[model samples]
Target: MKYKAERDCKTYLDTGRLFAPSSKSCHVGLNQVGSLPLEVRSWTCSNCKIKHDRNVNSAIIIGDEGLGLLALGTSTYCP
Candidate 1:
């Protein structure tokens, strides 16, 4: 995974704009600002009011970033 991440960060000659399709607005994280010891493993987005798991959100962000980079044409694939 680390190797893939590093590879994605590289710059590509094509320079085509890349964007990650995300549903982040639907899961804007918990609204409890100072609350500690979160009772649930998941929370609803204040903006869209959609429920989301902490782990799932993290994975989405990471995958989005990777895909964003890939779309930029910085892929390390030597084909």
Candidate 2:
């Protein structure tokens, strides 16, 4: 999934220093630095007040995991 700040003045916040593993699904993980809490399905940034998409964020995490070395090298198919 692609992340695009709603406004040109706004920028994405990165919270993760490195790859973060998924707590539930092996095929999912988060790569972006700063992210919203799991309890928060959606939120407006304190600074920008722009609505954030939770599904988009989760999709990005899963996409990152899919591109990882292990996922790409594994013969097991994932869909």
TM-score: which candidate is best?
1
Q: For model 2, which pairs clash?
A: 13-34, 14-33, 14-34, 15-33, 15-34, 16-33
Per-residue lDDT tens digits for candidate 1, residues 2-70, read 566557674333222342223232325424323323454665666567677755864665566667778
> Which 10-residue window in model 2 sums to the lowest lDDT?
23-32
Compute the lDDT of residue 14 as modeled in candidate 1: 29
lDDT of 2: 0.44
TM-score of 1: 0.50
Worst 10 residues of 1 by lDDT: 14-23
TM-score result, candidate 2: 0.32
